[model samples]
Target chain A: MSAQISFRNLTLGYERHPAVHHLSGEVKQGALLAICGANGAGKSTLLKGIGGALKPLGGSIDRHGLDPREIAYLPQGAEIDRSFPIHVYDMVSMGLWRRAGLFGGIGRADRTKIEHAIAAVGLEGFETRPIGTLSGGQMQRTLFARLLLQDARVILLDEPFTALDAKTVSDLVDLVRRWHGEKRTVIAVLHDFDLVRATFPETLLLARTPVAWGPTAEALGPENLLKARRLGESWRDDALPCSDAA
Target chain B: MSLFDTFFAPFAEFEFMRRALAGVFALSLGAGPVGAFLMLRRMSLTGDAMAHAILPGAAIGFLFAGLNLYAMTAGGLAAGLLVAVGAGVVARATGMKEDASLAAFYLISLALGVLIVSLRGSNVDLLHVLFGTVLGIDDATLMLIAGITTVTLLTLAVVWRPLVLECVDPTFLASVSRSGGVSHIAFLSLVVLNLVGGFHALGTLLSVGLMMLPAATARFFVRDLTALVTTSTLIAFGSGVAGLLVSYHLGTPSGPSIILVAGLAYAGAVILGPIGGLAGRFVPRRHLEA
Candidate 1:
């Protein structure tokens, strides 16, 4: 499989402190990967680096030729104002924004596509309802519908199933599987080991740096998990200044 | 007094009153929606700050051109934008909050503006700039207000979706489009532009009152952006008419009267509106069966 994203010694951080420390890895095209780690393991930061929301502190993230707009990224807790007065349909229609643009009104075909995406998430009746009024499950489903319309080659989901019911998780996981089956790259920051093991073919364990990167079964060994837990606890405030080549 | 005589006769009797109504209407048509967005973005107070931010420039313009409309408008726009951009840059570079930076800058701007105005003009002239003379609006002021309204409405039409998307989900837009930062800066500029426009008729202090009061009023009764903007505009225009009539009948300051009317509407919405009104709590309906 072709390398969809090649990270060459990428060091992403904030204010000179590395959130995702010096790391190098490639996510192959059409690979479904799970990034698993403890709290503050830089999973979301790594996803942000790929999504181009955060610039790498040192090295480059090579997306080959994928435009930033061509990547569908859902951040953890998604900085969305729940009280914003937007209808579910209007919010879903924003998925086609890459094609529709600022002034391009949604055409009849686009409208149908939005409706179909909404229905696929089983939110058909909630089209006109304000997104604020929806339950967390319904909101997640709405986001999944938006992901469906995005049709990106690479999909990055940051804890997409957090606090969601089992049913909603299964339904969204199915969508992730569908994307994987369609030869699209899907990277998710997931905590649930069972879901990660069952759905994700590749796993990258992170603890501010890469702990393991390989097949799910091998990378998630008990020893590796213990080491990751240890590494997470050892965050040093007076750590040696990062050498450029490190 | 009949309805026709009470409502329509004031304007028929005075050209100044007609011009004032026209100016306020145009202002309501533009600033109302702009204010609605400001309130939605939770930058309602930012609009208030920006109003003061434009003061030094307008005062400097007054000092230079002796109340020349174009000079004052240009000067105010420049000052407002300067404070807005400066505050943003300061907040980002120095790690201070934007509101903190803005408050500091606008305070300085306000003091400088008052000093400048007082250097060249009498207390009456200062009062004119501070409180405005809406009933004494010239043709040039009318045209300027109308032109600002037109530009604002047209710009809103073009940037509506991105603006809304930007407000609700800033991170999402960044992933999908590179226009996220651009939209935010553009929205900030629009707020400044509308504030400057409002300054022409309502003056520095009372200008933002028109923008924010109606928006707050609309918020109580409306749930969607379109409805929020529409209702705010209607409320603002209605306040303009009613307030102008009240000012005419009772001989009050037109600017304050208009703002007071909008404030009354806001209070009314809070007390009486159906969505989340105070009255609804006292007069309860049975819970919905979901």
Candidate 2:
């Protein structure tokens, strides 16, 4: 399945203030792309524009000849209410809602898909458990289960790892690499510089305005890295800079 | 008496008893399901608003239409829905908190209802509107209640899944845009209808109390959506029948009696439910697994 998405000079905003201005980019069919950005660089806004959750203030976003629903979007898991008394299985099953069609009951096939997705995410025994009971890592995996159930060729994740442990991060990175092996396009809004350099071949550096977009080796060099750090600190006014990117 | 005789007695009653029973069934049909949604949405206060807002509408309808139950009910429903939507819109536009807006709306509606009743010059009618009379129930009123309940229940059943989905994940659901604001509005409209239906049986205050108490009670015992709805309906039906019987046997007001029974169920659920905060005598082990 060929999955290609293009954002052509897209300007996104809420009300009159623009979040991402004059953005233009293209995701190669079945290519793994990482979006590296400073805080308030409108990475989430750009993703929302591309995902059809928010309409672009200007220009257009085209998903090659497929519907936007064919793309799986895993929003930052922090946005979800963890205290909600919903079972992990039920939460994952919602990803099939688009394909299952409105008013369509969950059948044998849907159940099989849900089970496979859960198992793939390594949540084998947590089907009956409430999502509120899960750890931060487990919650991320549950969201991954939802992404898996969508069965889309294109995956866009917004900060899938913020407070996860080291092992969970590695497991998630491995899952993304597996998706890459299967020729699925993975675009992630990530903060870890080392993870991007090691795992992602292509990187798009954003700092409100487009900073750079190309191979990680070229785009994430010391100068571009310095620029990102400066922009992030400029936004926060007190963000510390440490040489943590190995 | 056998179960058959007890159940069939309502059908075998004269005009007054027949009207009262019909009114109970009508009120339960809409009230039960609507209460379940309100409980899930954590907006049981909106149900309270609907019931309280109906007061002025009923008073005005009585003044203009001269005790015509249908006209008065129509007036109440229209006014209730209007105030409900108006409060919501005002809350959004002004950036005021919903709680503040609801409080303002509730007070205004209550005051307006009382003023209208006072202007109509009948303390007896006002008292009846406050605490309804089963003996005063008539056939036309019964038919109106039945028709309204059937429509609201059917509409609710049709939109049940999406409504539940919206309540569970409103952000994701709204992001997709498949679930629109229309469903929320429709659900609120259903709440208004249920409140209006119950208004005839239990009056305004007692009607809302009965509707909310049963569903809130049902939540502690049930985890699934279907079970919650079923439990709420059963609670409403049982209390309704029991209240009507007690009212007939003893000379107490049916409205308050039914609400009292419903309140008892709520208390029971709180005391004996799986998640109850009782002194841990029958408490289950931590059942939620990761």
Candidate 3:
């Protein structure tokens, strides 16, 4: 597969301390990859960097030709205001923003597409309901519907299955598989090793630095897992700045 | 016959009353939706701060031009925009939150404005700037209010989709479109423009009252933003007419009367509105059969 995204010595962080430190890797087109890491493992940070939400503090992320907006990114614990007075249909339709744009009314075709997307996510009857009234899982489903409408070549899911019920998780996972079947690059930050092993062909283990990268089985080897655990991501504020970070 | 005279006569018998009614009507039309948007953004306090931020600019205009409508409008617009844009800039550059920066700017603005107004003008002039004369509104001021209202409503319509998207799911909007920040800045500019328009009749202190009170009142009654904006505008409009009549009869201050009417509606909505008002909270409802 040709490289869709290539990171060259990328360093991403808040303030000056690097959370995703000295990473060099490539996400090939159609690669189904899992990013496994501890709580502060810079998994979300890396996703943000690639999703264009966060600018790289150092190095470069070469996306070849993909526009950052074209990459559908789902951040964990979505930054949406739940109390915002928007209906599910309206919220889901916003996924077509890349195409419809500002002042571009959702045409009949777009409405049909939105309805299909909503039904796909099992939110058919709840289209008119306000998003504020939705439960956590239902809200997640709504967002997934939006993601489905995004129609991007690359999809990044940060802790996609967090706090979801078993049924919901399985359904969302099937959707992810559907995206994979379409030959789209799917990168997910996952905690469930079982799910990763079963679904993902490739894995990148991070611990403020790369622990291992390659085939899921090898990358998540017991020794590498132990090394990742030992390389705790806590910041030592007084520690001298690393010269190689540049 | 007397009842008709009480309400209709005041509006018909005198031109000033007619102008005041027209001024407040235009204000209600524009300020209502603008205020509703402000409330939705959870920037109600930001609206208040911006109102004060415009005071000094308007005051400076008063100092130089002596109550010239155009000069004060321009000054107030400049000042309000400066604070709004300045607060946003400071928050972005220095990592300080926008609210903190806004509060800082507005305090300075409010104090400086009062000082400037008091420097040359008498206590009555100071009072006039602080609490405007809705009844004394002239043709030029009426035109200013109407013009600002027209601009505000048109702009609101043009930016409605992006503006709503910007408020609801800003993160998603940012990922999908570049209109997030543009809509935000546009919304802020509208807020300042409405305040500048309102201050001419309601004064800086009470101007935001028209913008915020009706919006706040409408929240209890509606769940959808469209409904909220419409309801708020109607409430503002109702308050404008009612307050003018009350002022016409009671000899009370018109600006305060208008705001007080809005405040009353807000309080009543909080207690009685069906959505989430205290009464609804206490009153038991039949459970939804799943």
Best by DockQ: 1
Clashing pairs in 3: none
Which of the numbered candidates is closest to the native, going by highest lDDT?
3
Candidate 3, A45-121: lDDT as tens digits? 99989989888888999999999999998877567888888899988988898887766778899999999999998
What is the overall TM-score of model 3 with all chains considered together? 0.96
Give the local distance difference test score of model 1. 0.87
Q: Give stretches of model 3 more than 4 Å off.
A: B1-3, B114-124
Give, for candidate 1 chain A, the lowest lDDT window spanning 10 residues: A233-242
Of 2 and 3, which scores higher on TM-score? 3
Ranking by lDDT: 3, 1, 2
Candidate 2 lDDT (Cα, whole model)? 0.77
| B196-220 per-residue lDDT for model 1 (tens digits) | 7777777888989888999998888
Q: How well is each residue in A1-246 modelled by candidate 1, as lDDT tens digits?
A: 989999898888777678887788899999999999998889999999999888888889999999877999887655898888899998888899888888887889998999999998889889999998988889989888998999899999989999999888888888889899999999999999999999998999999889999999989999999999988834567877787645
Q: Show model 2 residue runs off by greater than 4 Å.
A: A1-3, A58-60, A63-70, A82-85, A233-246, B1-22, B87-124, B281-290
lDDT of 2 at A2: 41
DockQ of 3: 0.74
Provide the lDDT at A28 for model 1.
96
Least accurate 10 contiguous residues by lDDT in model 3 chain A: A73-82
Q: Score candidate 3 by lDDT.
A: 0.89
State chain A's TM-score for model 3.
0.97
Task: List the lowest-lDDT window of 10 residues for candidate 2 chain A.
Answer: A237-246
lDDT of 3 at B140: 88
